[model samples]
Target: MYDESVVPVKMESFSGVAAKSPISQCIKTVLGRARVEKRLTIGLLPAIQYLSKNTNGALFCLTAAAPPGDSATHMQEVLLQAFCAENDIYVIKVDSEQKLKKLLGFSETRMDFSCILVHYPYTDPFSDSQEFDTSVLSEAENDLIEHCETNWDYAQMPVIKLPEK
Candidate 1:
């Protein structure tokens, strides 16, 4: 039941020693920073809930391509994409779920996640502590924002579709 009309997006692999794209590298850096800051919202349901509850935070969402034949999962991704679009949240589609898990340092655990929402550092007026240093993350975020704004239209969601077996 493969749909020939739906073209799959080009997927990038991070396993080999190949040179990574600037956008990809920025994404990795953002994810790493978010992880260290404990700002990641893992899994589909949790991400949805987080998005629903928080409307004024800087957010980035990463989703992996759904495996072939999993219509339910594919539909869920589509839904998430639509929701993100409406909320102005940036969505990054990775090559695979396994790669995402590895990037988030969850490969050693039994947990599985296809979607991760990163909460970027933001200034809080009421906080007394010094702000977290986010120079690297800021640079990466700026690059990613530039790429997305210049290369793609706002209406187009860059969700990667897994190829058929």
Candidate 2:
């Protein structure tokens, strides 16, 4: 089981934004887009592997806060954070793994997922396989990027904390 002692980093603490802030909305939208486009990498090992091999996209990572005293989960969280930090990826921490799974449209009995990696590839005009127009997503991404630039300290790992339910 995941530990319960990990403290949540509140969004307001870093960005002064509430739970319903535009940043949160953008995140939801981006996640939806990534899901529809099949650009999301779920689970810790898959995410790590994807990040290790792919560098062609704008990457965003979302992780559930590790339960306190769950050394394995905590270690996974730390390792993921370090990898993201080294790669200049944005990492957002949500309240729990179940909530995150629900947000991703998984059924209640599905395997628990602690981490999700969303990859938004740089648009390729010449590719016929690009079915969806991503202009709206682009706008949301720009907003998120601007928010991060304005509010977060880039020197440290960019981990936006979502309020707990």
Candidate 3:
């Protein structure tokens, strides 16, 4: 069973953590909800006893090979945030690439980007791919349209920048 305390946290709630741009606030809101909901879904103590560890599922992200503080990485994160804002997927800029890689089960030696997806998973038609179901995506789009008001232009949104180390 996953420890609730170990659940991934957003930058705002993480003590001593701060972000240099407004984009972090948006990222914090989305990731924070996901993290909290994930723990609540898993329940605690005896409730956890009935469910198998695997049934708890996993959080998926569409990460790139970007690292924070690098100019290229900053642009990559901003573009990523715009995309996520468009699709309603949560996005975050992680400074600790090594930490995220390790958490994603990769060896510590292998470093990778930390911008990841928090979308719900569904079965894909391809045997080798994990693409989202089209219907599901469409439904999500409709839901987003119904409930969310968004501005597609990145300038209109709170642009994300790298946090100071």
**Model 2 scores what on Cα lDDT?**
0.64
Query: 1-165 in candidate 1: lDDT tens per residue?
Result: 425422322333222232233455667777778788888888887887877777545467788877799899889889987888677777777667776677777776755477888876855657775543345355666655554544356565554433221
Instruction: Report the number of the highest-lDDT candidate.
Output: 1
- lDDT of the structure predicted as candidate 3: 0.37
TM-score of each: 0.71, 0.68, 0.35
Model 1: per-residue Cα lDDT at residue 86: 74
Q: Higher lDDT: candidate 2 or 3?
A: 2
Clashing pairs in 1: none
Put down candidate 2 lDDT per residue, 45-140, tens digits, no spaces. Answer: 788788778644436778877768889978978897777866767777665687566667784666657888888754776887634344535555
Worst 10 residues of 2 by lDDT: 2-11
RMSD of each: 8.2, 7.3, 14.6
Better of 1 and 3 by lDDT: 1
| Global lDDT of each candidate | 0.65, 0.64, 0.37
Tens digits of lDDT, candidate 3, 29-76:
434455444421221121223222432222323333354357865565
TM accuracy, model 2 = 0.68
C-alpha lDDT (0 to 100) for residue 39 of candidate 3: 27
